[model samples]
Target: MANADARGRLRRPDGGPLRVLVVDDEPTLAELLTMALRYEGWEVRSAGDGLGAVRAARDFRPDAVVLDMMLPDIDGLEVLRRLRGDEPDVPVLFLTAKDSVEDRITGLTAGGDDYVTKPFSLEEVVARLRGLMRRAARSDTRPDSLLVVGDLVMDEDSHEVRRGGDEITLTATEFELLRFLMRNPRRVLSKAQILDRVWNYDFGGQANVVELYVSYLRKKIDAGRSPMIHTLRGAGYVLRPGD
Candidate 1:
């Protein structure tokens, strides 16, 4: 698709402009990136450090993030972890130093969706972001937004989760993980599969996130109630109707 057409299609679900967070210590660069994104009819916000980046992300709920790998308070990887903790599905594009191979590798390995080296072209950054946004659009497409298995129910469009006629709250990551489980009821889903299908990126090889997120889901989804999420030893996890 043409850049303009593709950009037009990548907007908020509410039909508003796409929200983008630009995090860079350099003011001039940040301004330039912001201007470019804004020209594309997006709502743009910029942060100058890791702390500000994290804070802005929470407040803005951006559709995508442009994050620098180095920051005054925290590195980009740590910022990514914090961002993913809350907004699991937000795509991130890293800004690494020119020819910094290690920075590029570490950024992607840490779950950044894409990266552009410093001294890069504005067109390149915008283009890469378009690509990431496109991939995200495809990943997010599903047949049914309402998913049910037993007493647990999720309304994907409304972002509501409830069980046993009671409201249940979950972070962005928790919700997506649960949705993936609910979509494939009674089927074993390995950590590898979860990483590939749900997360779509490895956590610097820290695959334990599968177990960690599962535990989080259990606390919210199954505690003090009939268990629906199950772990088969040496196998994987599955979701089914509770007894």
Candidate 2:
């Protein structure tokens, strides 16, 4: 909720410290998360119910939120839906005991950026939250700039792609997938990882979506250039700067 512009992109004006909201029915867990976030030098607040979570989010306007699935008043998914309705681009990390495939899918489809099952390591959660905040900060800073990889350039703000000065058209999903791949250049990403990171959903029965999107991206990003996005048999996909 914090750093929210008209377009829903997170921004921290005046270079203020990062702020985070922890929403969990368990007061101790909320406090623990709050403490962990604070250890990272972030300002944090906590809430114990859905309505309270919403209110706290509105007032605190955190850069990111760590929400639980089970709540007293409303469900976490509903809370996420409402949050997105108000600020679509707010970064959300679901920290819940709902570890089922369906639950993960529901959380992501509701607009959450990341999901961390309960009983998770505090270090991992903090690292993932930091990654999300970093990405959000980058998005705010370069809202309309072109992301470059070798001779391929993808203009995120303009939704345009060019290779060696030749413009390329891409579908919205293709663009998003490509941007994700480019942003993490050379990092091996499994289909599950790609689905979670790019599609923002669990690949319950939709693992092929990653392959489909990869093909779509290839047609646009590597049609006439060296193959930058490579698929490792039995592994996953990696986007390097060059072949």
Candidate 3:
């Protein structure tokens, strides 16, 4: 049964409990996660292996998933690949003991939405999950709000971007960052703010990843054209139409 905490309900935009699928082979950890999520008044389900995770994901149609990278059956990436085949937009938070930068990058580059290293604080996990779910809910409810700055336009509903009549393909993270920028055009955004909004402050205050992704975005959105994304030297980045 779903937990009924009137004050603690994790409600979706539709006023229903946010459904979460927790996938972990560690039985105790899985139960702990289930309990914690339930305590937030979220509808929670559990699966002990990759195959079961995929099956439960298909059946439950969860709004988000807390997935472990290690699994007994197929591995978490494979399970994620399978789950995404049905619902590509569902946010996924990866849980694992892999603490290396390469491991985190591998998970993110492999289409996982967020990565949480093991030996983590449950509060941090809950905060990250809440952020991801809020992002998803915002996109789902306001998909038609097309963001535009000069010749650049982003259709959040269709997940399409066009610049001066040229189409651009962006990864999910890139799209989200761009969307954030577009929503606040002409305003400089600090690395801290961007980290808080885009990366969820999970990087221990390191800003290199933010710079790296900004460079990545510049190459795609500004290369061979008048740049719309500008670095403000010791300040932050801003999106503005070139004069």
Candidate 4:
């Protein structure tokens, strides 16, 4: 279990500083973020526009990105799309002036891991990045990244899920929900628990979301096969071998 130092600087497996890319159209803000990250002993780079951000993402290969929602050439969402086209699971933190629910939802729905509003404290940004790094580390060190239940197989590293020897593609959210079920095979998980673990409490409490995602999972993982996901009436849901 690796821990950050007093300054909250993260280290890679090779003991080098964690690399971060800051993408913001505002030069001063970008420089501020760069300086703050550098103070934390992280290797930081800045891209003042969306195009440059996309270019740098390919060239810099940053561990995490701090991207502004508003960019010059293209919007931050487009930049994120381009980045995800190459790296589906890249960690991103969006900085946005509009803190509306829709905006937040849009960012998260687009695969942004986290978001920070304008006029944010530098410390808060650093903290969020640190949390992302920790999660990334945990994900990398998974003792068994490949999960199998019956004929369904999920490879965490490659983000691939297969059922009955047929490849199944899933959205990021769907993949996460299915992974959670696979990890707890045969154990009944309530909608509340699923929501908390999968979408986080920040998403508010919507039990229907669990049902919806489960339905989505069923279509992909259970259709035309002995269903592995089971509805236990009042007990919630479970994943186990189907007869």
Candidate 5:
């Protein structure tokens, strides 16, 4: 776990500073996290309650989220649902009680990517978030830079995707998942493979996040049109040109 310095600062795939949303009812704790993340050269936003967290997420569009399970309102689990209900399967790191195994289990089962026990160091939080971002980053240097399968096109260098000449807007995480699908074309990517490549965090075998994001992609890429993304029952997901 090397320190993030100005010279070696990590950035988002779009070449912008990484964004993180910190949700905690304690103003002092939230401010400390905010300052630490900012010092690492990333954008930071904070919310004191569940509703505010959801609102902040919409306005901030953060790349990652640091959530506190003990919230002043609505609790952390509900907030996680609200956030996922929106868009972009942003990696969530839950802060929980040190002795509460149940809190840890519930958080991961509810779609949190990772967590840190209370009374933890700020350095640990920063390191964990950095790891998530590193795994989420797109492979920018590709020999095929441009991927084309039928009417769908993806430009890795430009971070752009188009289907049937319609430009499709995607979040950083969505773009990474779509890019993996396009790169493989008709190949069936297993849940394990997708998790390792798309989300490197340990979710204790939890993989519904894959299903959730795929559903999101379908609404945008296949809604009211031929479906290019397909689920193969017992297999995994396969992306092909729509008929």
Candidate 6:
């Protein structure tokens, strides 16, 4: 693949260089993505196959990855699954030609943090990458304070949830889902959107996974109390302040 550095224009919050990995079988597309990332002052690496991408990720240790769905050796979903198994919190953005709902859900469920369809605007790709990077940075700098909504309270640093002065226990996944909802109280979140944001994947195997988890959360957060998690039929779930 052809690689060249564009003039430096982007910088990290620490004023240091950002790093990115571009994994695509198409040489031209990979080069284009590399150029765009470089123009943002990010150190860019390119890999043309799934195996090569994995090796490159290990060697380059990028802060974010832009991966194409179709690759020569291994499928992108498999690649993403492997990557996530090794680094669950690593930010991955998928580039795909397949835009079907199932395709998007599969990509998301396979552990992609975000996805961009083919023939997409480079500006949107950059914006999505920036958002992923910002989110990753925020995850590392969580505040010590508690998040409160009505009678519910969650300790950010401790991963502790409580309601009406009673402690509640939740699985890691449930905690994350609840945290995301509480963070955006009253916002209408469709199941697909919840899967994308909270699960960091699209709804794949079971769209009901969101509903099941919502039930799990309710058992913990509101089993003997008034319901705060509302299910909007044909829509999704929302966390308000009361029953």
lDDT of 1 by residue, 1-243 (tens): 112245355676566788899999999999999999999788999999998999999999988999999899999999999999998878888999987877876676567766777788898788767766765665466445778899988987767899988999775556667888998999998888886666555334535657767887898899999899999988889998899
Which pairs, if any, clash in model 4?
none
Per-model TM values vs. the true structure: 0.58, 0.65, 0.82, 0.67, 0.57, 0.67
Clashes of each: 0, 2, 0, 0, 0, 2
**Which candidate, 3 or 6, has the higher TM-score?**
3
Sorting all predicted structures by TM-score, with the top scorer first, yields: 3, 4, 6, 2, 1, 5
lDDT at position 217, candidate 3 = 82
Off by over 4 Å in 4: 1-9, 143-145, 149-152, 163-166, 170-178, 185-243
Model 5 over residues 1-243: C-alpha lDDT tens digits? 112336767766566878899999999999999999999888999999999999999999988899999997799999998998895457788999989877876786576766788898898799778767674543434444788988989887777788988998765556778878987999999877887777665544446667767876787788888999999988899999999
Q: After aligning candidate 6 to the native by TM-score, how far in Å is the CA of 175 from where it should be? A: 7.9
TM-score attained by model 6: 0.67
Give Cα-based local distance difference scores for all models: 0.81, 0.74, 0.81, 0.80, 0.81, 0.76
For candidate 4, write residues 1-243 as lDDT tens digits.
Answer: 234556655786677788899999888998899999999888998999999988999998888899988787998889999999877766788897744555655776666776777888898788778766676665566665799999899998877889888999876567778888999999999887886666544333356557766877798888989989999997789999867
- Which candidate ranks first by TM-score, i.e. highest? 3
- Model 1 residue 65 CA deviation (Å) reads 0.2
Give the C-alpha miss distance for residue 190 in model 3, angstroms: 0.8
Model 6 Cα lDDT, one tens digit per residue, 1-243: 112225433445556677898999989988888898888778999999999988888888778889888888898898887777676667888887845555655676555666777888787788778767765665556779788999999997777888998888654456668888988899888888887776554466436557667766787787878889998898888889885
**Candidate 2 overall lDDT versus native:** 0.74
